[model samples]
Target: MSSQPSCSQTTPSSATQSIRPVSIKQLQTLGGASGDDDAL
Candidate 1:
């Protein structure tokens, strides 16, 4: 159904949103935002 696909898409969307900031923060902790793009 439509709801099934919406949920599937939203799950990854939410995860990516969470990871985007987390990745930057993690790289910042490791060193700096220099490798942020590469990390992603």
Candidate 2:
């Protein structure tokens, strides 16, 4: 029972770790584009 819960917890964390970087990179790209437009 304890092991099951640990496994479940780890699964979501690993999934999020994979997704979070892609999301951050996309946001950074969009922010940079907007910032450049604002500067001009």
Candidate 3:
């Protein structure tokens, strides 16, 4: 699961650079759907 950290890092950076709204939405959905996984 070493690749998991890389994926987690890349996802937020890419999202921040590309789409703010989508990132916000994804975070919101993740927060609502899963409390623990929201750390991603």
Per-candidate TM equals 0.66, 0.53, 0.44
Tens digit per residue, CA lDDT, model 1, 1-40: 9999999999999999999999988877777455675688
RMSD values, in order shown? 7.1, 2.4, 12.1
Specify the poorest-scoring 10-residue window by lDDT in model 3.
Answer: 31-40
Cα lDDT of model 3 overall? 0.86
Could you give me the TM-score of model 2 versus the true structure? Answer: 0.53
Global lDDT of model 2 = 0.98
Tens digits of per-residue lDDT, candidate 2, 1-40, equal: 9999999999999999999999999999999999999999
Question: Which residue pairs in model 3 clash with each other?
Answer: none
* Shift in Å, residue 11, candidate 2: 0.5
Pairs clashing in candidate 2? none
- Tens digits of per-residue lDDT for model 3, 6-31: 99999999878789878889989887
Count of backbone collisions in candidate 1: 0
Top-lDDT candidate index? 2
lDDT of 2 at 20: 99
By TM-score, the best candidate is 1
